[model samples]
Target: METLPLQDYNIYVGDFDQRLSDWLAEKVYSRLLIIVDQNTKMHCWPLLEPVVSAYQHSLIEIPAGEDHKHLETCQQIWQTMMEARADRRSLTIDLGGGVIGDMGGFCASTFKRGMDFVQMPTTLLSQVDASIGGKLGIDFMQVKNSIGVFRNPQAVYIDPRFLRTLSARELRSGFAEIIKHSLIADREQWEELRQISDLGKVDWPKLIVPSLRIKQRIVEIDPFERGLRKALNFGHTIGHAVEGHALETDAPLLHGEAIAVGMIAETYLSHRQLDLSAEALETITDFIRRIYEPVALDPATFPELLRLMSNDKKNESQAINFSLLPAAGSVEVNRTASPAEIVESLEYYNEIVAVGNRI
Candidate 1:
């Protein structure tokens, strides 16, 4: 029911296959390209294909992973779009996770100097979070969202039905963003998620409104991300670094898993330096452990991870800034801590492990 601020753009968020197809037939431009990852091409495209068939739907598939969100990958996608002769009248319907949504939006925003993009986010992560916001970009030098632009989509189509095809890990991954959203703005929304008997068995109708309202309100206030918007990066500071590192290696964790760790570690920072209550941090840590595989970050991988974080684009000069949680539903930004503080934060994170609850 929530609509994007931009005119001529409606974010259709329920079961409306016939209406979606009918609307696409009426509103979308002439050339239609459905950008998707291989996984979505296999799992979700089947359901969406028929709806947009009339607009000369061109299926552009990229490799399904974070490693592919680079200039090289964009080059390939650009070539494919050109091969299809996508013009200004064309619309790119991004049909995948954040990688697809971000890259596809960027591709459309740049190619031909600007084309309309409609997000068709498949994963719970993208639907509830990434797909809506106008922040579009690809990774640069393996940094998370390092190369990109802030171009809103023509529309964002989030169908909960798509979540049925996602792997359990993928669902959990997106839920991290959901948790981040709730933490930054709405405690009641956080409680709704916490009380859910099954995170996977989400009540789509009951859930979509609060999440959309929160994100839309924030974006409306700070579309350019000059100040208030940076708060959205709460779990992302360390989460992004972890994501970049994992991508450098073979065992890359999906973004959400890395963020689950990021949230815990950043919460540690908040607990020690900021005014966040320890009880709330424990509740968050417990929730995360229930959903994700506990990553026991040993001392050996500590320095490299820390270095990767320093190299992150979010840093100002030599100091790395973070959107640390002072409390749930409240974030404090640019609270740059020293490297020693970061190490201590990691140690503090390890201490929070359930082995013997030091606190």
Candidate 2:
């Protein structure tokens, strides 16, 4: 097990071979609650039962879906913990993807003025991005992860075994973040990832080295998100707004899918607004389209999406903040954007992708 210590924070990440029960035996804890979504409860918990035998383990299964990322769902989870008699000494084992790690972390962070939690992140997205970061929160009023706090976990056990069970779409969704990570930090990793073809063919152990290195380096520079940490929000500006809008209604896009488009479109903004190269923009857009089908935004939906962006959490004042990629490893924040300019950028992105699809 290669352990990486997250300093001054409880977050411990590792490709751990030792069982969670054995790890927990060293620490004094009152009880254990293993939280899982409906799908994870059915597919994942059986493997854990054998490993977490030393503790008094209980399962708290919640219905899966973006609609459930609300205060009501969180309240129910808290209620269950209360019944389970979870106190400060108790721990939460978040055993699933981003939604599980994110929402579960929020519950543990607030439970009894904060209880410790471990992230047994299943999905590739959660393991590489969401789970590793101490950002824990739930959606509010149908926004994408709007209500949350930055609280580190006690441990993050990343087992690549879960990738075998992921559907192709889910696999593609996670790869998008890997692409984002590469774009933000390591240009070499970017080129290497671009060379990757079949997502199923990847050497799992090799991929984590670059991915975690980028996140750890970024977080270390600015743990409180005062400066450099904001760079991680590269594709998230419009991506999150689109996610928030779609999640509210009939169809919702995955985080990576929206971000794929977000990164492509944001590339245009980066070039025009931040002087990023045109070649790099094309490289990112082309690669993302290989994994994600760009959604055609109707004339009606585009405006509503913009409205969501206006309310983005990063916006300090009334200006919508953007993380523009001027170079491979560099980004700038607090970009002042006009409504007309933002709309034009989205329209231009659609034209490029639509032309490509038709060809």
Candidate 3:
């Protein structure tokens, strides 16, 4: 197993069974609180049950999906922990995708003034992106990650074997972050990624390792997100807004799906403001369009989308804050775009989708 050591923790990316068993044996916590949703409980639990079943642990299963990621679900997790008689010395094993990792970690971090937690992310999205950041929270007031805290997990165990359970769409959803990581930091990796036509045939461990390294460098430098860490938000600002708006609709977009839209729109902003070449913009938009399903924004929803962006946690002032690309493999943070320009970018996204639909 290859390990990427962060300042406070190590992210194990490979077969994690032995590593996890060893870690649990070494730590020997007073109790173990294993958090899972319906999905993970069914598909992922079996893989983990063998190692952890030997320990004294309580299983807390909640509903699955972004819709369930709220204060109400947190209350349920907290109540279960209370019933389990959990204390700071106890360990929380967040064994699921991003929602479970985020909400579970948030619950553990805040429980009795904080208990130790380890991330055993089961999905591709969670393994490469969500599990590593140390950013934990639930969606609130229709704002993505509006309520969160920065606290590193004791460790992160990413076993790619868990990815076998994902649907094709879900796997594609996770690929967006890998795309984002390459675009923002690794130009060469981006070149390698755009060439990928089939995810099933691809070797994930090779891709996940480098992607983790890119994020590791950034998060370690600016864990508080004061400056350098903002670079990681390259596609998140607008992506979060799009994601938040979609959550209320009949058809909601996955986190990475929304970010794919955000990346295209922000790439447009990059071309217009930062003078990124038209060729680069086309390369990005075209590649993303080929990989993800096209999402057309309603003109009527522009007002609400703007409102969501306005209230983004990254905003330091009245203007919405964005992290835009000046070029592939690099970014500029603390950037602001006017409302009209923001609408224009959204329109650009719609126009492209409309054109693609026609063809």
Index of the highest-TM-score prediction: 3
By summed lDDT, the worst window of 10 consecutive residues in model 1 runs over 1-10
Question: Lowest-scoring 10 consecutive residues by lDDT in candidate 3?
Answer: 141-150
Q: List TM-scores for all candidates, in order.
A: 0.92, 0.95, 0.98
lDDT of 3 by residue, 1-359 (tens): 99888888898988888989998899969899999988899998888889998888999999999989999999999999999999999999999999999999999999998999999998889998986678999989878777879898999999988899999888898999999999999999999998998888889989999999999989888888899999989888889989999999999999999999999999999889996899999999999988888879999999999999999999897989988888999989998999999999999999888887887
Off by over 4 Å in 2: 8-19
Q: Pick the candidate with the highest lDDT.
A: 3
Ranking by TM-score: 3, 2, 1
Identify the runs in model 1 with alpha carbons over 4 angstroms from their true place: 1-8, 354-359
Q: Rate the local accuracy (lDDT) of all candidates.
A: 0.79, 0.80, 0.91
Q: At residue 279, what lDDT does model 3 achieve? A: 95
Residue range 6-87, candidate 1, lDDT tens digits: 4435777776586677767677586888888878988888898777766676889899877888888889889999999999
Candidate 3 regions exceeding 4 Å error are: none
